[model samples]
Target: MTGMEPLAPLATAGRRIETAIIGGGQAGLAEAYWLRRAGRECVVFEARKRVGDQWRERYDSLRLFTPAWADGLPGMTFPAPRSSWPTAREVADYLEGYADMIGGSLWAGVRVDSVEMLGDGSFVISTTSGQWHAQNVVVATGSDAAPKIPEVASQLDPGIRQLHSSQYRNPAQLLPGPVLVVGASQSGADLALEAAQAGHETWLSGRHPGELPVNERIAGPFFWFAQNYVLTLKTPIGQKLRPVIRHGGSPLIRTKRADLDRAGVHRTPARTTASIDGRPTLDDGTVLDVANVLWCTGYLPSYAFIHPAVIGPDGYPTETQGVAADVPGLFYLGLVFQRGFYSHLLGGVGRDAKFIAQLISERALSRNTVAA
Candidate 1:
């Protein structure tokens, strides 16, 4: 808050900063707030041209399927009743405001190349723009830092006009014909339903019916119970569970059987894998004649900038909460559970950010220094 610059061109080259936040997303912005409140100095490096660019890049029709009550950032709420979940653009605007509140030290569009520990044990974070030195690092780019489109997705017929969920804007932007939506996850089902409702012949392919919501009265405090007691998501055993994680059931906007029927959204059998006679083919050997394909497959977390020595067999930064055994001083927050499952939620990031920020301050800047 004291000494801040808007756009820094490699701060006095080679001058070391105490810490560097490696993202400008929800996690990065949250951490920056805490880092400042704690009287710790740091710089935030964001690869995008502006804050909330990630959300801005999402589909135009996307909304926070999680209720509006869950959309609060550290010190601010969505400002309506708790039920006002924000659209993608609204969230992005909130983040932009957050950046302004934090004094705009976000160096946008500067991508990090590699982060290596020097002989002196400090971190040397090199980027496309320049370099920065920090005693501590927070990798808060979030889970969907990169999209996980399959290699074969590109090999589909050129006439198909394929688009991933990330690139999809609206049905109007799609081809002038029926559309085939692949994957049955929330994105897939929602897109299929939207397409069909927009007067496009839409077919959805998914094996799992996915999870459905419960009546609030009967379910009790399901969210609270799940976060505090259950092992469905971030708990120890659940983390080791399996390749197929339990779905969030249905999103708030339900894509139920009735909804599908009324919307004329057809559900083709699962296992659909290819394009036939220039159309998408279902696993049952049936073909859905269409000119557009929407692949809402999902995203993969990428840690390629991190060297393999610090990575595990799964090719991720092997860390616990914000602590990593192999890589000391390498803390990750706003990840799966620096606090809880809601840690990733807009409202829940403050707790995670505070916790991680406290740890960082203690380890890197505390007057009563405890060895990190």
Candidate 2:
């Protein structure tokens, strides 16, 4: 969809809406786009002061692994060249621009405190700002809510500077000394390389999570292949691999193995398990005397505000393709493999948004007809 399209009207703060979408990132924005397209009155409640604060808050050198053309949501295309990988700031800015273009009921800084289903079958969305009523609620908060720093990290010395991937902004944030980075996934590799390039001695410690078969320079073919064959649940291979992908972290995508080697970042095979006498210790009993540690350990699914039934004991929401079969009118988007592998991605959210929007529209129409 063209970004030039006429924007829908913005929602007034404190007003009750028919549908309430939590989070104003790409997923929530995509949901809002489709909901508005179906003539549904919805309001997006963002916790951050701005729409793309999530991306803005990431590390300084972070960029989209995919090209610009592959990073668009519903009703808008990212404004960068098709093949160019946009920096984190660029992607964040694009999201803000996309929200402006949509102009559809986005309420930034309205953090959702709790979501409870009322006895009357409607939902009461309580936020930091105020309470709002909605016939339907879509949790588009995306997958990354809580940073997954291990409990053992606290055992480290107070003098040592340790930061999670979410808390990391730039190499300058680290103390002046050798840096130890845990987790050998894309984020770990990226941070190690960046630290090395910034003239810091960097040691990357963790199990190698494997790498993508394709190179990073030309991501188009690999993207097409994965989207078509690997990511989709319809395929037999995808069905078999879905469970693995869900449980395991994705292989290195953005950072290549050669890139890390070229940057002179030392690679260690053991994971950093804990600290031994103020020094970080590896799983193999090796203690590292690094001044800084960056935990690229990824995040956990945190939907604690939702009802227990909506979320399984595993902490993940139980839903089928964005639709809540158990809880009618309660849907989810931006979850990993919600429908496909790209469900949490920018381009993929739009497809799920289209499906969820249709379901919501139908339910609303049915209720109106019953009332009539």
Taken over the whole model, the C-alpha lDDT of each candidate is 0.71, 0.82
Model 2 residue 9 CA deviation in Å:
6.4
For model 2, give the 10-residue run with minimal summed lDDT.
2-11
- In candidate 1, stretches whose alpha carbon ends up further than 4 angstroms from where it belongs are 1-13, 214-253, 275-278, 313-315, 336-339, 365-372
Error of 1 at 223 (Å): 4.4
Please list the residue runs of candidate 2 whose C-alpha ends up more than 4 Å from where it truly belongs after superposition: 1-14
Model 1's alpha-carbon lDDT is: 0.71
Which whole-number lDDT from 0 to 100 does residue 304 have in model 1?
Answer: 72
Which one is best on lDDT?
Answer: 2
Query: Residue-wise lDDT of candidate 1 within 1-372, one digit each (tens)?
Result: 343334343445355887788889898888888887777777888999998989898888777645556567776667555655468998898898878877746788888888887766678989887778888888887767666665556556787788889889888878899888887766887788899988999888776554446643323245535543453345675454312332223332345555776899888656567655656667688877778889877777677785423665644456666676666667776655444556666767777788788888877655346444
Look at candidate 1 and tell me the lDDT of residue 232: 35
